[model samples]
Target: MRRITTVLLDVGGVLLLPSSEVMRAAIGHSGIDTTDEQLRRAHYAATAATDANGGPDRVEVYRRTFAKTCGVPAEFEDAVHDLLTDQFTGYTWQRVAPCAKEGLELLLAKGFRVGVVSNSVGTIEEMLATAEVCQVGGGPCAAVEVIIDSAVVGVRKPDPRIFHIALAEMGADAAETAYVGDTARADVDGARSAGLWPIHLDPYGDCPDPAGDHDHLDRFDRLCDLLTSRSGE
Candidate 1:
């Protein structure tokens, strides 16, 4: 196997983060009385929105579910999407981990092709634009070479095809490429199955790689350490 020349990452939980406070505040502002029951319902709906069956259109998820939870019929898609966006992606993107950004820059400086391969059922481009990550016409693609969004691609992970697409698009061999994400099934196992090195990002101090090698970590600061520790960098 050759040394790695490409690095793939999962966005949402890693980059976007999961903010409970943000969600609570947004739902409270919806005038929908954020009760315990409402909280549980909202969580369920949000989780379902990510899976395969919920079907991508984030506005539909919020419009239908929020309406039911708030006991309202419906609202315009723009209004609903805006509401949901406030809850989920409303975080200040500038506050992202400096270590994460540094690690990315380090990888890029090492001449490694970087990209994002996320499991998203919503319009990722919209989210990217909202987060100030340029997505059109060769703008800021440096952050992540290409985004393989599930909503747009209509395909989820744990599938070899997704990894194959990434490897091909980046012009890198699977043997030399690597994927870093938080999920065990999707990131580690899937990357291994695709013949790429799997680096699980376990923030909770748990290792999910199953090999017990201790490559799992809490932050992206150690990314260079992992990539360079091996034959790849």
Candidate 2:
């Protein structure tokens, strides 16, 4: 697993996420009777299509992937895509993921340099502040050293340049850092390219790839456990 001094995380799925109930409702409006579990699976699958050209066409990428994964017909694809995009982009439809604060606090407590590298729409930093992420948790806590946003930086995932930007900002080397994200193509693919160890936050273990190709975490809080076990090994 190599030595890890810095821990970088993706914001959308790892910290801020669309409300599951809202997503279900949106998909239901398109006449698809899907469960929250299905929506989540589709969500992870959809994010894979988000690549370097992820800004303006973000909604379209997610739309196609989600509809296909959920088996939505062509007749309802447009409607479902619109509704899903509305849910993901609108702040009113987004909520902080559970254990996000606790996980960041744990990483900071363990002396890890933490930062955020997100493919965002220019408001991620503000959103993180609103969610109270990476803030002082009653006492001293680890602060995020940098936030590399695709919108602001003009570089998106699947391009190792973005990750390198973050590593440079943190004054850390790629081998000493680990990037945790939800999307396989964008996060894991990009992190590995930038020479950082990649960890996928796959709570449901729905990754289509074979097991053991990359480290996986079912929960954010469990990251501490993985790091602890690795250091001991």
Candidate 3:
């Protein structure tokens, strides 16, 4: 509402997603068959479940939710979860979302500063580069103002400190910036607490948000539409 001039993004789920190849391989190894579409749905379902749970055991919640969403039987759930954990512990999260680059380009074209603030394992910058999404400076990918990784910053989200780090680096005021992320607890609540506009990326329409405390977007293109419309106001 304050006229967003800066846009900070989360890496996983927003710009990048878990590698489908890795997911398929893990599922196949577990003797369970699945399709790309199902895997995509499963990822969002897992995130939604984690948001609803809002507990510290997020990894377990995500695993169990993903297994259930993927139609894994009770007996095979643990095995699939373990396999997925082993397969996805590294660079498997680098698969760039389809609309990421275009979305960033649209933001840049509209004269908005862009950056990243993600809860990652210290490799988000490199991973974004590898995925050709964007980076801190000019490159083949969209050039953003900064990238703040929580692991490197020694602060995680739902804590205002992490968002502050990005805001400081970008020299952007919190009220004039928007943080886009997938989960409600980490993204919406965190950004709101940091005094920034929080936009939740709910591609699956899963987040209930009965109180309607923040904005929700079904896709990156919808985000572009929202910002573009706001810019005109």
lDDT of 1 by residue, 55-87 (tens): 457446644554455443345434544656655
Number of the candidate with higher TM-score, 1 or 3: 3
lDDT of 2 by residue, 1-233 (tens): 56678899998878877667777776777677887567667777776555423567766887778777877888888887787766756453256776788898788888888889988778777777776675322423337888888989999987999999998887998988889998777888899999998999877676666668889998998898887677564
lDDT per residue (tens digit) for residues 54-161 in model 3? 889988999888888888888888788898888887478867886888888888888889999998888898899998888888789899999998889999998999
* Model 3 lDDT at residue 57: 94
Candidate 2 weakest lDDT stretch, 10 residues: 134-143
Score candidate 2 by TM-score against the native: 0.80
Our model 1 lands, by Cα RMSD against the true structure, at: 7.9
What TM-score would candidate 1 get against the native? Answer: 0.64
lDDT of 1: 0.61
RMSD of each: 7.9, 3.9, 1.4
What's the alpha carbon RMSD for model 3?
A: 1.4
Location of the lowest summed lDDT over 10 successive residues in candidate 3: 224-233
lDDT of candidate 2 at residue 109, scale 0 to 100: 89
Evaluated against the true structure, the overall lDDT of model 3 is 0.86
Record all residue pairs in model 3 with backbone atoms less than 3 Å apart, i.e. clashing.
Answer: none
For model 2, the stretches where C-alpha displacement exceeds 4 angstroms are: 20-25, 30-42, 48-61, 64-77, 90-93, 135-142
